[model samples]
Target: MPLRDLLLGLFVIAIWALNIIVIKVGVEELPPLLITTIRFMLVAALLVPFYPVARAQLPFLLLLSVTFGSLHFALLFIGLEHAEAGTGALLVQMGTPFATLLAVVFFKERLGPKRIVGLLLSFAGIAVIAGGPTLPSPLPLTILLLSALGWAISQLLIKRGPPIAPLALAGWVALFAVPQVALGSWLFESGQWQAIKQASWVGWGAIIYTAVMSSIVAYGIWYTLLRRHPINRVIPMTLLTPVFAVGLGALLMGDSLGIHKLIGGGLVVSGIALIVIKFRRAPRLA
Candidate 1:
């Protein structure tokens, strides 16, 4: 990769890492589902004018929207609401392994030895993180794991589906997610409207940052890298996100630097490194 592209990738990682802090901040003032809904609404409204869609894509688009936009964010934000930001960031890394497992089982993709080892390492790390005796609450761990699975499924769907511009796909998903989130807020958080109306400027800033930097700019740059470079090179950069998140969480949220985080984060990073190293050494077929 060129220095410029590498820098862009690093920038994306920074935005995503800080996004965990943004979520932590946003959820303090606004309900998770409501904040998520507002963010997606803004993203959808911004992208709709640039990327017009046809009626034929509605079904798949709706599915993508619900899975990626509504379900993913709803579960994630709620999980973050309960879990420590650092721990939540670490647990969400499971999505990569979960997506790999789905690809192997459903799509007949081969999980080579390194990939298998990576999956096991990641799972073991998650288990250690979740089962750590000092964890404040078990429910947050459970919710975050489910959130990771939801995101993994969404990734698999995106990989299997017809090719679409990343922004267009994101826009359609956001547009479809609005109703679901609104309904969820209504059913579960009836009084949230008043809360949202009284949200502070910090909360609004967090939402805007998530929608514009994390969603639009990060994803846009990521898709650009995907198109320009091999997946092996681009995907490994994502491992840095949680690292940044953990650091930022400690600095910003005063989250403790526990032994479990150090050990688990090490395993996760090492596992991903092993896979990338091995994959790079493998011979290519004609």
Candidate 2:
């Protein structure tokens, strides 16, 4: 990759990392489901004008919306409500291995030895993180794991199915998601209306940052890179996102650095490195 593309990818990673902080902040003022609903609403509004979707594609787009937008965010926010930001960041990295497994099972994609090794390293890292003394709650860990699975499923669906422009797909997904999240918030949160009314400027700013910078701008850049580069090269950049999140959580949220985190992070980074190295040497599968 060119230095420019690498920097752009890093920028995307940074935006996504900052998003965890934003979510933590936003949830302090608003209920998780409501915050998610508003974020997707903003995303939908921003993209709808520029990327109009055909009615024929509505069903597929709706599935994407439900899977990626509603289900993923719903579980993530609920998990974050109970889990520490740094641990939540680390746990979500499991999505990569889960996506790889899904590809092998559903799409008949073969995993090389390095990929298998990477998967094991990642799982070991997750086990270490989970077994650590600092885990907030067992329920939160379970929710985070399920959130990771949802993300993996969404990625596999995107990979195996119709080729939609990334922004367009995102827009349609957000559009479909607005209703589900809105309904969920209404059904689950009795105080949601009061919370929305009382939320401060800082809280609203966090929502805007998540919807615009994190979702729209960051994903737009990522999709651009993915369109131009090979998936192997582009996807590996995601490994840096949790690192950034962990650093930001420590700096901003007063999250502690611990032995388990250090060891698990090292293993996770090494696993992703192994996968990238293996992909660089192997021929592309037809």
Candidate 3:
């Protein structure tokens, strides 16, 4: 890969990694659901203008929106309200492992021994993280895990659904997500009116970062790179996202890293690496 593209890829990862922090900050200021509602609203307003989905794809698109947009982000932001940003980021990595397992069951896909190990290793790490006696209320952790599963389910829906442009799918998800998320915010959360009225720049900045940088710009660059490069070359770079997030959380947000977290996080990232990166055989000699 060229240095320029490498830097660009890192830039996208940085945007996504920083997004964890932004989300943590945003949830601190405004209700998590409200922040999610606003983010989806902005995303829809911007992308739906340029990218439109086909009528045939609407039903599947709506399902995707429900899982990818509402369930995932709703639970994620809400979970992060009480969890550490770094820890939440680490837990979100479970989405890949969850997706793999769901694929095995739902799509009748096969997993090799290595992937099986990866799956076990990842979940064991989660157990370790949550096993600590000092662990807070299990509610946030459970919500985070469910959020990851929702994301995994969304990926499955995308694969099962009709072929649609990535950004177009994202736009439609954002557009449809607006009502679902807004309704949740209205029903479960209070003080939405006051949150919008009194929020500082951090809260609103989180909205812009998530809607524009994380959703659109980061994904735009990502798919462009995927088209130009091999999946192996591009996909492995994603492993760095959590690494960056952990560091940023500690440095920027002062997220505490307990001993259990250090061990558990290492296992999680290592397991994800095993699951995601294919170890190719050496070239054969004649």
Candidate 4:
């Protein structure tokens, strides 16, 4: 990668890392699913007008809406609402292994010894973290794991489905996902009108940051890099995201990194590193 593009990739990672902190703050003031609904609505509104969609991709978009936009973010934001930003960041790393497993099962891909060890280590790391005191409860961790699985599934779908422009994919998925997420908010959540009325500038700013910077700007740069560069070169750099997220969570949200977190997080990251080090990459989380 050229130096400028490398920096741009790092910039995208930085935006993604900080996004965890923003979502942490946003969920404190608003319902998690509600935040997803609003954030994606803004994302769609921003990008849909700029990109034309093909009718053939419409079915794929609907499926992606469920896996990527709705299930992924709905569970993620909900889990992050009660979980530490850093921990949530770490746990979501499971998406790598989750994707690997899916590929092996569905695509009949073969994993070498390294990947097997990596998978075991990743699960062991989650097990270690499950025993840690950092998490408020098992529920958030469980929810976050589900979110990661949704994300992994989405990756496979995108890889198999007809090719679409990155921004168009983002836009159409968000467009289709809005109603699914909105239904969740409407069903399980209350006082949305009151919450929207009462939310401060901080809450709304967090939403804007997520929709614009994290969703559009960051992804635009990232997809450009992937298109212009080799997958191996661009992929390894993404390992920095969780590391950056953890540090930013400490600095911005005053998240504590306990011994348990250190050990568990290390295992999880190392496991993910082992998985991603050799093989490939993706467009990143939605």
TM-score of each: 0.94, 0.93, 0.97, 0.95
Better of 1 and 2 by lDDT: 1
Q: Among these predicted structures, which one has the highest lDDT? A: 4
Q: Identify the candidate with maximal TM-score.
A: 3
TM-score computed on alpha carbons, candidate 4:
0.95
C-alpha lDDT score of every prediction, in listed order: 0.85, 0.84, 0.89, 0.91
Give the alpha carbon lDDT tens digit for every residue of 22-60 in model 2: 888888888898999898889889898899877788888
Clashes of 3: 0
lDDT of 3: 0.89
Give the lowest summed-lDDT range of ten residues in model 3: 129-138
lDDT of 4 by residue, 52-82 (tens): 8888889989999999997788899999998
Local error of candidate 4 at residue 100 (angstroms): 0.5
Query: Which consecutive 10 residues in model 4 have the weakest lDDT in total?
Result: 277-286
Please give me the total number of clashing residue pairs in predicted model 4: 0
Residue 123 miss distance in model 1 (angstroms): 1.1
Candidate 3 local lDDT, 1-286, one digit each (tens): 8998899999999999999999999999999989999998898888898987778889888989889998798899998899888889988889999999999998899999999889988988888878753344789888888899999999888888798998998889988999998999899999999989999998899999999999999999999999989898999899889889988999999888788888888888888888999999999999
- Backbone clash pairs for candidate 4 read none
Greater TM-score among 1 and 3 belongs to: 3
lDDT, residue 122, candidate 2: 86
